[model samples]
Target: MIGLGELVNSEGEFGVDDYRACLAAKHANLERAIQEEWERPAPDQISLTALKRRRLKVKDEIVRLRTGKAIGRRLAAPA
Candidate 1:
């Protein structure tokens, strides 16, 4: 639930290169995790558990980014 106003300042401050690097890192990490998990074959229950953990990891990162951007925007805004 990040507000656009809060992220405006962050967007202005972060260069394209910085954003690209961040995206690259995130994608690499996610791909690594999925590949590691898919390598192991398991029962249905275990499969579900693994998927849930993966989903949580992704969700956590998303939340962190959203909050960070919101805070950054507020700080960047004028008084």
Candidate 2:
């Protein structure tokens, strides 16, 4: 199964940056929704919980992509 962040271009590297941007936008939207829910006179706990969970999952995906896409490692032989 191809994951959203795992899709690469024909050149062997796709727009990780672009994907990150999209995720960032979604995260922002989710955050706004959460805030709006919180500010309501009677917030729905169930709805709030679901929104928070989705936000958290999105955040985690962002972090995962960040670590995988933004890191550089030097492979060396141990002496």
Q: List residue ranges in candidate 2 displaced over 4 A.
A: 1-14, 69-79
For model 1, what is the alpha-carbon lDDT of residue 72? Answer: 40
Clashing pairs in 2: none
| Model 1: residue 34 alpha-carbon error in angstroms | 0.7
lDDT of 2 by residue, 1-79 (tens): 2344454554445465656666788888889999999999999999999999998998998898878855453322223
Q: How many backbone clashes are present in model 1?
A: 1
lDDT of each: 0.52, 0.73
Model 1 spans with C-alpha error above 4 angstroms: 1-12, 43-79
Question: Residue 60 deviation, candidate 2, in Å?
Answer: 0.6
| Global local distance difference test of model 2 | 0.73
Model 1, 1-79: lDDT tens digits are 3333433444555433344345445656656666676676853667556765765675565565656653443232323
Clashes of each: 1, 0
